[model samples]
Target: MVSAELLKILVCPSCKGDLEYDVNADTLTCMGKHCPECGMPVNRDGKCADKECGKISKNFVGLRYRVEDDIPIMLIYEAEKIPLAG
Candidate 1:
């Protein structure tokens, strides 16, 4: 389990967004949507939602980081991008 103090300073490496920690699961999830290609949260559907970019995806994706020994990995390369299932 991650300590509250350590969890407070953690954020997503990719989007710099807030991360939700699950103590029992020992995992941290990025709350923001991100484009798998651009590495940016440009769209609500995990694509470049920008009008100019005009990229869209049916899949919604976000990142998940694992916490080991109360320390978060916080590595973008190591982070897993999981497709959100509705």
Candidate 2:
């Protein structure tokens, strides 16, 4: 996983747009609406928004990463795309 610092600087590879952070999941995310940019999400309860978008990884690609610990599971390959429940 890239450091919070690096994640802050990272952008969506597909669109070169800004990525939003999911603090609870400790992950970086960029979930676009139908446009896949100018991101606008309607937050819900007890579920992760960006995480679900990442499951499909339908938008962002070519995810590069930097690890902070021996955990060594920061790669996008490790991130499975899923859908966010409203």
Candidate 3:
């Protein structure tokens, strides 16, 4: 579980947005809540509720979290870069 204190320190590089703790993924996430660039939800499913993705970026449309065995695969170059909503 990610501590709220740690989540308080995360930010979105693309938009200088504030990030929140994504409970389901246990990863930090930016609160674009809605993608300003694409004007869509960052998640493929278009959800803005408690359930969110923690990956730093999502430059693609159909790609999901690149986790293995419940572990996050935080690949720098492969990370998806989503346009932030903030």
| C-alpha lDDT (0 to 100) for residue 23 of candidate 2 | 48
lDDT of 1: 0.74
Tell me the TM-score of each prediction against the true structure: 0.70, 0.36, 0.35
Off by over 4 Å in 2: 33-86
| TM-score, cand. 3 vs. native | 0.35
Better model by TM-score: candidate 2 vs candidate 3: 2
> Each model's C-alpha lDDT?
0.74, 0.40, 0.41
List where candidate 3 sits over 4 angstroms from the true fold. 31-78, 81-86
Q: Measured by TM-score, how close is model 1 to the native structure?
A: 0.70
Better of 1 and 3 by lDDT: 1
Model 1 lDDT per residue over 1-33, tens place? 988888888888877789998878899999577
Ranked candidates, highest TM-score first: 1, 2, 3
Tens digits of per-residue lDDT, candidate 2, 1-86, equal 44566665666543355666554455555443221221323233312145545232234222322234623234444443334432
Judging by lDDT against the true structure, name the best candidate: 1
Instruction: Write down the TM-score for model 2.
Output: 0.36
Candidate 3 per-residue lDDT over residues 35-83, each given as its tens digit: 3333234455443222334333334222122334544433333434444
